[model samples]
Target: MLTDRTDTRAKLWRTASVQRGYFTAAQAKDAGYSYQAQRYHTQHGNWLQVDRAIYRFREFVDLPAEGDEQLVRWSLWSKGRAAVSHATALTMHDLGTASPSRIHMTVPRNFRQQTDALILHRAELTEGDVEERVGYRVTTPLRALVECAAVGEDQNALDIAIAKALSQGLVTQPKLLYAAQQVGPRAELGVERALAAAS
Candidate 1:
């Protein structure tokens, strides 16, 4: 019986080592560790809990190195309503020079979170608001620029986003004007300028 238990532990360790950093409880269970065994492994220093049902190996692994930490965090934070946007969307579009302090995502009206790292906004997003970019589902560059123009209090940021979209030829003048009209007068100049440049 002791040998059998040891074999299970060894198997779990080998499965975890290959993953290197993180695994969910479901994943651990799928890898052959029973719930009680998984708990025992945690108590014995084999796994560390990062969040509810999320586990990582005991040794520290580089979260940034994997390039999917944000995805993992997003998955944990309710994947349905969250879509990367604003300056983070700019970064994803490779159109601007700003580094957003936190992951900028928009959630539905009812979503909430405990951390400030997630800037949750209550908004309605349709299929039109989302697009595939660099293999990830994100707000389209044109849509994100318009969104920034509409909601961003910083005129400079709005101008930059509009300019970038225009310079890249992603939005035409008529479309820009139409979008600005939808947002109101505050966004008119930036949208007009972007449209002119795109023409």
Candidate 2:
């Protein structure tokens, strides 16, 4: 009969904390709380709604305190259909000086998420484009740079990314050239120059 009220409350707290300040209504239902109980918790200041169907711990609700919220937001966005990219990826790779104000993520063209914290775009990626970081999947440094070069307006950023990737030995000159070719004219000159330097 699920009559252990104390045990249920403890489980809810543990579940919410484990998710790092985020919970969904569906998760609450699965955890044996009614929709009304979920609302009651929110109204009582035990939980705070961070987004539609997303709740967070009232004490740690600041979205920009660190990159963790961005990761969580990305995970909740589009069935986790997002991967870090652009300046964010450059930061992760330690390949640039720019600190993006928002988390950059790539999703399919048809996917949508209801948040402004993410700079979302559409692109296709292969398995080689992704890497695992901090237990979360993200675009590899090389692939992210190429993606940035392919779409970004600034060529110098792409040049720096290429140089950084080469300096780190994270990618070979030939591979960079191939990726540049794939992205077309936007990246061709940068890739060619980087390749020449590497050779």
Candidate 3:
């Protein structure tokens, strides 16, 4: 029979598994770890303190795939309001070879987190504009390509994303057309140009 402590550890482990080993103080509290207990765990090497109120379980760090940890961490840092986006979203969807120098994210207008590694955009995302990753969300392929084009990220990156998405059956041209229509003229033109480039 599982003791109360074992039950709590199981619950926190479930959350940490999805998040690639990271969790917030609030989450630890939810899993029944008091602040003092958290401090003890960190001191004993069971948890590694990451940022203020953020932590990583030592065993779980070796568990994530490449390129996803930063996204997961920043999304947690935003308390889950931020979506990995723009060129970063394109890469998340495996549509490009881009290794962006900065992590681009879109957050709700009221959200704020300043960091040298992050390029944050303020916007409230519609459900269709975002997709779920294991522990975080990312902008949809259509939104990502359009956003990159709108901000003049890189023409070739847009072209490659659209082309690869279409080729992999990840998106259809009609779906792309609908997404372009939703974003309005400048973005529509941008999507069209990339679609043309892809074809």
- Candidate 2 clashes between residue pairs 3 or more apart in a chain or in different chains: none
Q: Could you arrange the candidates by TM-score from highest to lowest?
A: 3, 2, 1
**After superposing candidate 3, which stretches have Cα over 4 Å from the reference?**
1-3
Model 2 per-residue lDDT tens digits across residues 1-199: 6558677766666766655666677777777889898889889988888777777777666545655555664565455567777778877788756777887888877785556667886887677888765424578877777767666536666676677778889877778778778878876676665556545
lDDT of 3 by residue, 1-199 (tens): 5349988889899998889889998999999899999999999999988888889889977675666887888878889999999888888888867678888999999875687778998888999899898889999887887787677767777777888888888888888777777766766777788889887
Worst 10 residues of 2 by lDDT: 68-77
lDDT of 2 at 113: 56
Off-target runs (Cα >4 Å) in candidate 1 are 1-48, 56-68, 132-136, 183-190, 193-199
Clashing pairs in 1: 173-195
Q: Rank the candidates by lDDT, best first.
A: 3, 2, 1
Which has the better lDDT: candidate 1, or candidate 2? 2
Pitting candidate 2 against candidate 3, the one with the higher lDDT is 3
Which whole-number lDDT from 0 to 100 does residue 113 have in model 3?
68
